[model samples]
Structures are given as C-alpha cells and as structure tokens.
Target: MKKILLVGAVLAASFGPTSVLAEEDALLVEARKVATSLPPKLIAALQDEIQKSGAEAAIPVCKDMAPKMAGEISQQTGWKVKRVSLKARNDARAIPDAWEKAALEDFDKRAAAGEPPAKLEKGEKIGNEYRFVKALPVQPLCLGCHGPIDQLSPGIKAALSQNYPNDRATGYSEGQIRGVISVRKSL
Candidate 1:
C-alpha cells in the first residue's frame, strides 16, 4: 500500500502546476526576447528614412522584406512568426487562412483600445490553424510603411501599386496591430 501511495504521489508531482509554470516562464522569456530584439533599430530607421523620402522607396522594402523578416525571426527562435497586415477588403487570397485573419482582427481591436495583447494559446484558431498569437504594435517608425494611405506620397503609391497590386495593408493608425508573432512548440 505504501509503495502504491508513493507511486501516485510521484505521478501527481510530475504533472503538477509547478511544471506548467516553468513552461510558461520559459516561453514568455523566449517570446519577449525575440519580439523585442529581432527587428533591430537600424531596419526601422531605414524604413523611416524611406518613408520620409517618399512612399515609393518605403513600400518596396516593406513588401519585399516583411515576409523575409518573419522567416528570419522564425529561424532565429525556432518558432514560426508571421506578419498579418490588416485589410479593408475580404478577398479570397488576401485573408485565405482563417486563423491568421481572426488573429489579426483580435489584435487590432486590442491595440486600438490600448490594451496589451496576450499570446495566443494552443487550439486557438488564430491565423493559420491552431496558431499561438502575439500582437506586434506599429511603432512610431513603422508609420512610414503602415500609416494612412492619404498621407503617402505619390511615389510610394506608385511603388505599392507596382509591387502589390492587391495590397490591403494601408491606412493604419499608430499603435495599431501591424502583425503577429506566432509559435507552435513541439510536444
């Protein structure tokens, strides 16, 4: 009977809240590090300069590098990261993946209200399917690429039209949700 009780206690302890807390701490630490540091200041400064010079210069960089940046972050952290720009239109391909679409919307609302967004959990249907989501707020520097369309220069508009004919990521306000950082840790 004592042996049986000891085995039960061991099993319970192994699966206790303490283990879960440790996992959460580890994930949070990793997430914060990559989110805060991966996109260094120089990249942001360059984007700002491009925007100030004219939209044309900045849009190209945003269009070309957004996805690549996400990929790079994923490579650095071993966790998948995705950027989901908000869109006014609901076209098939623009928002093809339901999870990404939903996550973006949710993040937008929280960001607009000035509430800090939380990390998406497993089983949450955020951007692609069971995506774990964290919001990426538009920094002041990000205004160059993501700010209101009306403020964009003719050159920028032209560049945007040339690069992404179906681009729907414009007309954003400061502190808006520009994208998300997603991760799916292995079991």
Candidate 2:
C-alpha cells in the first residue's frame, strides 16, 4: 500500500506541470500555425512585385497588404494578429503595448543568447487573454529596403522618404531582429 501510494504521488507530481506545459505548448503551436501562414504569402507577393515592378512597388504591397492580411487572419482565426517593431516605420501598427514591449525585449535577449530567431516565441496568459509574440528576423531579402540608409537605391530611398518620412526602420543587418508577429486572443 505504501509503495502504491508513493508511486501514485510520483505520477501525479510528474504529470502536473507537464500537463500545463503541454497545454501551453499546444497554444503556442496553434498560434504559430496561424502566424506562419500569413507572412510567406505576403512575402511571396512582395517578391513577385519587386521582380516585375521593382523594389519600389513592393513597398506598397507591404504597407497595404500587411494590415489587410492581419485583419483577414484575425477574422478567420478569432485572434487579434498584427506586426510590431521596436523601431517602427508605421507608427500605428508597430507600436507595442505594455505586455508586448516586455515580450519584445525578452525575445531580443533570448535571440542574443544564441536562440534561433525562428524558434523564439513568448506566450502567456494575462488576465482574460492569451498573448504571444514570435520573432521575425531580418532576412537577406529584407536588406533591400531595411538595410543601411546609404545602401538604398535612389528610387527606393526617394519612395521611402515620400511614403514614410519619419521612418526609423533602417540600419539593420541580416539575421538581426526586425519585428514580431503579435497575437492576442481573449479567453
């Protein structure tokens, strides 16, 4: 009887946190699936636009499609999904709220500590909502517009100037953190 009780206690103790972790992991997985679908499609469209109409044309696709894509995904998934940055080009969407600011800083630290940017994510339950943030590293392709200001082509530079005059989103290197996909779902 003593051994049976001990074994039962051990099993319960072992499964407690694992059960919670597993549930949270499932939430992260679902959020990831929702986020992962949107960006590549937008990136593909941006790339094709750049290939045909030049890099200048791709900017509008990003500016316009990003929000539309977010809205569509939010509607379909019942999650409030958006992109944000520490240094924002679009002030409206890129501004991080209190929780998001903390998550972004944490992600930056984790990424600097040798974690893969693609694998870095933060998810938590706060009050009546669940929040998650996934890192979006600066890809080699992103450097065309997002890299150093001096490296930008004349046309691209002029377009950025006209479109986002107060842009603070330049001067990034490849593999660096650019922004995040933030999802908030109400419980």
Candidate 3:
C-alpha cells in the first residue's frame, strides 16, 4: 500500500506541472490579447490630440493612461502586466529581466534582417528558473517614445526622464523587439 501511494504521489507531481503550464499559457494568451489591442489605440487618440494641442499637454495624459491601462488589465485578470524594451543607445543599461533581454536581442536581429515580428523561445531562465518567453515587436506608433532620441519631442523626452529615470527603453524601430510577455506558473 505504501509503494502504491508513493507511485500515485509521483504521478500527481508530474501531472501538476503540466496543468500549471497549461493554465499559465492560457492566462498569458488572454492578457496579451487585451494589452496589445488597447495601447496603440489609446496612443493614437492621444497623438491626435497632441498634434492639435502639443506634446506638453498630451504627455501627462498619455503617461497616466499607460499604467492605468496596465492596471485595468491586472484588475480584470489577476496576472501581473508590464512593458520592457531594449537599452537606449545612450544609457548604461539594465533590462527589466535578463532572459527577456537576450530574447529581445535575438528578436531584434531577426527583425532587422527582414523577418516577422513575433517569436517564441523556450527554457530561457529568468530570475530563478527557466521559462517560455514570447516577444512581440513594437509598432510604428511606439516610435514616439521608444524611437531615436532625435525623433522625440522635448516634452515626451522630459516625460520619459521623469517617469523612468533609469530607462534604457528608447531607440527602437518598428519591427524590433520592444518587449515581451514573461509568464511563469506559481508552484
């Protein structure tokens, strides 16, 4: 009976991880669908207003709106949400997570060579253990903040400086890895 119990325990343990991965993957897919659809439309609406009024007036609104959207997604789905990008051309840099950083670098290389925008990589260790990472390329609208320094408006740059003082999240072109959705299951 003890041996039978031990075998059952082992089998449950093996199945547990698989179940967790499936759940995590499902939650991640949902969260991505929500996040990706929201940001660009918000940014475009804000950009139209900015064109009429100017960046100074629009920056605060956009800045506030960004995290509010992230917060909304978090509230709706109990998963953490975030944004990350490649190091700026000028700053001494550290990515939000290293595994993500490496994946972005590879994604950027592939994109630069005229490839597709999204990628999935496996077994990339972040923090404590390996995880599956999905990198999505930032679109043209993202260039206003994440693009080259010369292209940024003074107000937007000021906003970026104030919001993310250690930011290395600029100088990204369209089709480059702006960041990723990194999800792992809680054991």
- Top candidate (lDDT): 2
Write candidate 3's Cα lDDT for 41-91 as tens digits.
666767787688876677655456755676676677554555555663224
lDDT of 3 at 52: 86
Candidate 2 lDDT over residue span 98-156, tens digit each:
88888788888988888888877788877777888888898888988899999999998
Tell me the tens digit of each residue's lDDT in model 1 across 6-78.
9999989978987876766676666556555544643674667565875455554554565577677778767
TM-score of each prediction:
0.66, 0.87, 0.60
* Winner on TM-score (1 vs 3): 1
Q: Put the candidates in lDDT order, highest first.
A: 2, 3, 1
Is candidate 1 or 3 superior in lDDT? 3
Question: Which RMSD values do the candidates have, in order?
Answer: 4.9, 2.7, 6.1
Candidates 2 and 3, the one with greater lDDT: 2
Total clashes, candidate 1? 5
How are the candidates ranked when ordered by TM-score, highest leading?
Answer: 2, 1, 3
